[model samples]
Target: MVSDPVQQPHVPVLLRPILANVAPVTGTWIDGTFGAGGYTRGLLDAGATRVVGIDQDPLAIEMAQPWAGQYGDRLTIVQDNFANLDTVAGENCPEGVDGIVLDLGVSSMQLDLAERGFSFLRDGPLDMRMSQSGPSAADLVNTLEEGPLADILYLYGEERASRRIARAIARERAVEPITTTLRLAKIIEGCLPRAKPGQSHPATRSFQALRIAVNDEYGALAEGLMAAERALKPGGILAVVSFHSIEDRMVKRFFQLRAGGTGNANRYAPQLEEESPAFTQKTRKGIGPDDEELEINPRSRSARLRIGYRTDAPADDIDRAALGMPGAGDRKGRKG
Candidate 1:
């Protein structure tokens, strides 16, 4: 049976950076993550007349639903993946929006819940699906071939010991299909060498990889970014908060490309495309959480905030390939 994870206090990272870049103004905005409605509250208090908050988790929607009456008609909550932002946002706020905020990564609430299976520190089920649908991490670990499994760990989790982990998982599954978070964590820990100084747990990367693969988190982010680009009005602000290196890299590259960077190049005579950049980055570099924020919220340490403006440039030829997304080209995204 499914159960709700205990709600952890969510302290949004890089709040000042987001506030500075977003500058809410007196119009509508989209809180793409809306975990606990922290960002949405900030936007509304900052003078935004309306805010549309979207999340894939129904629990999150339920948690935020009570706040609807508090904000009156100013708040809109839709349960869907942020990647499907185009369809969801279009249906809810067809008038187009002034700003968008994407706080990417697993919510602290999800991690705090041992049963959610997002944290290696806690024992729980192997399910890591954000939407509660699709093949779960358990299914993949128990059923997928070793080669494909290794590739998933390598590509999604960026785990260096992907092959070894895959081999170990395959071996363990043969004895008995790997189930529960602790069992998988133990298997991964066994496959790794002894830690040298202040090393992290061996299961960290595998858990991260499993979670990403189960939810197709990277693919979802790419689709969401593209959708935001489509739904936002020209000159509207778009801010993204990425919690991992992979997600940050995607955001950084997307911003660079949208801000008009060359695709590829040679030494001297570069093969350049004569096209205008779509976005102008508000912050030259990604902004990280400050000492104060890190002290208060340790989870904010790895967070990075990047902001840009929507340009009038065409979405076509914007190099959706760099986003490394799947099913993104399909304009008709899944329902919330």
Candidate 2:
């Protein structure tokens, strides 16, 4: 999940649009990125017979254990990546899921807890692994070559000063391994200008970039989207809430391609041949939070929702490059 700029308040972004799109929700559904269980609870309350909540984070599943019993069999919690959602959906509902929601927003629980290292606002250990397993941000920062490190920041984080940040990190780590979050934030800050009034913190983009690299979020999202296409029955709805530009672009393109529409970013460039139209889109454009939702949840400012309905066409593989995934499975730091 590429996190939102601000910590979520447990309000699922653009949920109203989802519920309205699939009003009187019924049958089985999957909350692919079950963070705080906000989308799960919403679907349950809105009338879904069962919501199979899937998350790779152990902490998220553990936290849900206390109240999950109330829903009993109506709520099934699975600790796994959404990329494997098709397998889970098959086990839970042999027929097919009625709906699948992939809210790619990071949980506030992870952000508020400084120990998770997702936020640069509070000092903590330099660990941003969502599953809390595998190489950490510290491992990448302290060990990755400067060129690769700069690439992560530039491509994944979209930071223009990635090389400068990489040089600073190399210099600082040579003195001592950068183990803490604040220390890394300080290193990034020194390379970029300080935040001006309404602008985001200097370290925000770098931190997001590092987190994306550590978790392989872009790869997972690309896989998960195809997985959703395969798992959904004809007429099943797939709704995605993306927080950043790259992710939003990805969702938009996926829908366009699957719906037999143009997926090209550059309209002036030659357009690729349309596909078999595996899905029909809810709207041609992505839906953002309305004024009312924005008033209640300012953290949702960057959130965008795109919904698509599955068709009878068989699911097919898509080029990660077509999805605009960073590295395009070509990054030296992490291979897809």
Q: State which candidate has the highest TM-score.
A: 2
Candidate 2's C-alpha lDDT? 0.86
Candidates' C-alpha lDDT: 0.79, 0.86
* lDDT for each residue of candidate 1 in 230-298, tens digit (9 for 90 to 100): 888888888999988888888887777678876642233334475677788756698988888989998
Q: Model 2: per-residue lDDT, tens digit, 9-59?
A: 577788888999888799999999998899999999999999999999988
Cα lDDT, model 1, residue 45: 87
Q: After TM-score superposition, what is the CA distance of residue 115 in candidate 2 from its true location, in Å?
A: 1.2
- In order of listing, the candidates' clash counts read 0, 0
Question: Candidate 1, TM-score vs. the true structure?
Answer: 0.89
lDDT (Cα, 0-100) at 330 in candidate 2: 38
